[model samples]
Target: MWIATLALCLDEDYELIDLMEQMKREAGVRENCFASLGWLLHAKGEYEKARSYVQQLLNEHSLLDEPAIRLCYSILGGVATAFKEYDESLIYCQHVLKLCQKCGEDAPLPVAYQDIGEAYYWKKDYDLALEYEQKALDLLPEEHLQRSYIYRVIARVYRATYHYDLSLSYHQKVLDIQKKHLHENHLDFAAAYNSIAAVYHNMRLYEKALGYLNKALSICKKSLPVNHPDTQRIERNILRTINHYNRKRQYKVSNIILLYYLKSLKSDLPDTEHETCSILVRFLFDGVM
Candidate 1:
């Protein structure tokens, strides 16, 4: 179990996932494997499967201990958040928070606050989102790796509220924390790059946005499955940003200004030649001559 915890923290998930599955086949170990297996599956981005296992854990045990219940709720809440079920996410996370309060457990408090903060973020309540995420951050030690998650949520809140500088600052903190724990090409790095790209995009800095987006896409390609939703999402974002850049560049060439330029050019050409060129310009600009 200690090795399992280490495997999870270190992102050595494939072997840990296999070991957990094997443990589930054994008799007494099966009961103990559920929460760990559920969390590991969630980390692997197998959300439906994670939910299935966690739900099974809840149903099989009439009376799970506090830690098991907290893990179960946390996994379910995270899956709900991934699926955009903010209300359900809030319910599960709030339940965990209440349970912690009743049990006088302080250790899970930061996790509960982070989870609740994320749900509020998706619900577009930026004030509550920042407040809860700040509470989570305050609970964490300065160098704690878990602070990265709280920093990310705060970054997203800032991004949504149009505070680009603050968003970038928090995102930088997230990257700094992740770099210390995760390898250079870790999928978490891809997520952080993608987040920073989003901030640049909102700031209308398309070149910087494109640069970060490309880095994120490269990492995703190296790590995630070909058809993974995250890979496809980054692909779509790249296309959208490219389109926006092209449109912005096109807007810089004012239609009236271009027509005036053409009129001036017409003065220096024969009427027949000018008419031919003007027709081409009109067709190109209006899609009809």
Candidate 2:
């Protein structure tokens, strides 16, 4: 169970799979083992496998009360999110919220709220996302890892709502907390830098955006595998920002100019690599003449 928990938290998929198989063989399908396995699978984005185990655990654990039931809902919410079933995700999160309320202001309340906020964020409801994220932040235990995630969520909501300054503030809060509690090259640190850069990019502060994006790209390149989508995305974003500024010199540019340029680029090249390259080529062509 301890090994499974560690593997799930660290997103070590192969280790979790091996540990789970050994555990199942030794324990003959225990509820706790199934639950842990389910969570591990969920972390790996194997929603079907996760749902199988989670459903089994839910079925076997007839006397499950607030804590255990809340855990099941949380796992289900994650699985639904992975499958892109935003409405289903929201439903499971609502279950968790109810369970939290029933548990009388319990430790799980913040986590439940966080899940709901993430669901709202995924659904593109920035107002609800901010509300739920703030609620989660208010309920979160001081100095907890969950609080870092809540701060990040709030930052995302602020960014989505075009509140770049507010987004940067929340992202910086996450960065400060993570720096104190986590390793320097932690993925969460990369995530924070990336998010801050995104806000800067949206605000048309290309140089500042490039600085943070490059930092994130450096950390991601070192820590993550070469093919990791996040690393690749950040690398492309850095290139895009450089190209964007390069292109601006050729024409009268403003925030509106950049916004329209990005919107047009979004249609042809949904992935970052193609978009960045296309923008760079356009910039070079415009400037060379």
Best by lDDT: 1
Judge candidate 1 at residue 111 and give its lDDT: 79
Cα misplacement distance, residue 245 of candidate 1 (Å): 2.1
Q: What lDDT tens digits, residue by residue, belong to model 1 across residues 1-289? A: 6435644553554544443443234212234544766776675577897898788778867646767788889889989988999999999999989888877744478878988898999999989988999888888888687798899999999999899999999999999998887677777788898999999999888889999999999987877655667888899999999988877776665565467557769487777777776666776578442
Write down the RMSD of all candidates, one decimal each: 6.1, 11.0
* Model 2 per-residue lDDT tens digits across residues 29-73: 444543555665654446687787677668868645546666667
In terms of TM-score, which candidate is strongest? 1
lDDT of prediction 1? 0.79
Candidate 1 contains a number of clashing pairs equal to 0
Q: Write down the worst ten-residue block by lDDT for model 2.
A: 22-31
For model 2, what is the alpha-carbon lDDT of residue 29?
A: 41
